[model samples]
Target: MGHPTPAAVWIWMFPLLLLESRAGHLGAQETEMLEGQECRPHEQPWPTALFQGVQLVCGDVLIDDNGVPTAVHCKKLKYTVRLGDHSLQNKDGSEQETAVAQSLPHPCYNSSNKDHNRDLMLIPRDRASLGPQVKPIHLADHCPQVGQKGTISSWSCVTSPQENFPDTLNCTEVKIIPQKQSEDAYPGQVTDSMVCANESSGADPCQGDSRGSLVCGGVLQGITSWESDLYGRPERSGIYINICHYLDWTKKTMGSKG
Candidate 1:
């Protein structure tokens, strides 16, 4: 499955449509072996549901001081973080929900452009506790190499424009695409703060996968941001907000808020 189109396009396509919308480093061979591995229940614990009121539009979880990280575009909601759950429809004892007290999108975030610069936001949770099944993912200390492999997980739609989100969490492997290659595919859209990835076999993050994490070598490298188009085209690569590029800003924001 490939990622779906952006919500902006989905709305025009279907006026009646409802809204919605990683692992460690290893040898090259070892990395290839881990691709597309389905995460066990709460296996990747840091991935929490980012909700806008009642709708799940992105994935988020704790960073520090009860702060959660997600895409800046996701700031448009009265957000909540749902932790420790694999299935959204069926919540077990492990699931915990926390209200967001504050949301701080990056100061340079610009929604009108496709560049996706500083496309990140931090949400402070109210009285949330960290447990075994709910934890924070480490942010990457450096940027990923162009060919490095990474992992992404989400409960978002598997099929584009279809709302076929899985009951359980899903994951896929992706290889980083070089800036030149990404620019060739996206044409003037890939910015320094953005990264691109795609699977040769055609799996991708769609509409519902926004704000999800891109983990590389046990650290978060990116945030699911946007795609080339609204339709799911396997050949088209997906764009992400490069976490490494904004580490200083992230730390400053989180620190200042506290």
Candidate 2:
């Protein structure tokens, strides 16, 4: 799952949010992530049934008083993403539905600002364990070369310009904009764990795209960080976690087989 878009007005659009909990604060707020009232652009539609088998869930997590991961909280909301098989959602030739079980944002991610650093997170469904149909997305250890093209997929609103919220999984290709490495952040606010892509202003992430995948060379690179401007602007910015630099950290944290 993704962090809450901090813009303010974006939160007001999602009125159905299950409020009453601490995480419910965002139910009445609106940010750049939710701008379009209705009518999305044609180019920004959800992917075909080719990815129909996979189920997408949206969840949120909270830190405990001791700063330890207390429990995995689940959400009633679910994104319409298909992986490889439609059977998961098929009920006697009909459709089945699933929701989010638990979502854990990176420990270093500061949702209060969401400028940069540790923008990626993990989402797992309690009812549907990581199985063949629903497998963990492969993490890459390298970044895409300059000018290289890649695909990003997610069930966020950015995918569909027509709808104010996500109705299905959307995927699109973007180029890796060449960026100069510097000890100092280039964008003035970017962090060491973040990288830039797609210099073209209109080719960036937009509203309803938080926590979606920034894929390149078959690698899940970044997540929808923030929009450069609100009100459904075309140009946007994303905050991606430096996956290659954090391989060791992930293995240790997730107990990978190596």
Candidate 3:
């Protein structure tokens, strides 16, 4: 569903939990749509697996004078992802839900390197409190092995004018392009810490899907960031911030006190 107007985040996906509409009608619709759907969680291919919903950003998140993304910066990690059930108010008789992310951003991130690409961060939450429908995914250290396949998942709003909530969650498959990790290349210098993926041809990610996850091996590996715009044409390439390099940083940042 669309986020309330004026708060449009070019790449942000609205969690079903925060929809403006009531619970019963939307919940029923979601259930019916998901019925018999072939898509399963974390089963998608690489590169695409790196797409994840970026959450809980702070005011310090900057944009350049030209409107290009300057960084994936945030002042805190109060942002969260909801799984299994989509209500801010925990339901009665509902299974105990868990908030698995217990981490934060790397302290050394500079907000000027368009290529640093080190913006979003995550942490493993306590799984012992997890509900039946909620669980964590795996993270990969590099781009998928040669010819690896991945998928990009999002609760993309398909409805028009984006009233409080969109009608459904949308998913599509994309392939991970094979590239080398290097220190002097465009995405190379950060390749060790980030990964990239795309559809072979014709297919591409869209607006309102930014910060969505690109998952692989059941773990979160990358974050959807910027994409190439050929001026008036659809986006050609999508960028993501690699998570592996900052895994340690996440732990350290969240562990610090102000």
Please report the candidate that would top TM-score against the real structure. Answer: 1
User: 1 or 2, which is superior by TM-score?
Assistant: 1
In candidate 1, position 86 carries an lDDT of 85
Each candidate: RMSD: 14.3, 16.7, 15.8
| lDDT tens per residue, model 3, 1-258 | 855665455234455535645677787655333111224432332111111234322111101110111124422334432333222233434323233234444455566664555666433333323333434345454545534555545443222222122222335465555444222233343344556565533233343235245555555555665444322222243455665655555435434421
What's the alpha carbon RMSD for model 1?
14.3
Error of 2 at 138 (Å): 1.8
List, in order, the clash count of every candidate structure.
7, 20, 30
Lowest lDDT 10-mer window, candidate 2?
Answer: 62-71
- Candidate 2 residue-wise lDDT, 1-258, digit = tens: 876676655677455454444355555343323322222222222121212135333211111111111111211244432222222243332221333344455676666773555555543323223333333445567765667776555444542234333454444556665345322324565655655554233334453334245667655555445434423333244444456655555545544211
Displacement of the residue 221 alpha carbon in candidate 3, Å: 2.6
Candidate 3 wrongly placed segments (more than 4 Å): 1-81, 85-103, 112-116, 123-128, 141-143, 157-167, 180-192, 207-209, 230-235, 250-258
- Candidate 1: what lDDT? 0.73
Order the candidates by lDDT, highest first.
Answer: 1, 2, 3
Clashing pairs in 1: 3-205, 3-206, 4-206, 5-230, 21-57, 24-217, 25-217
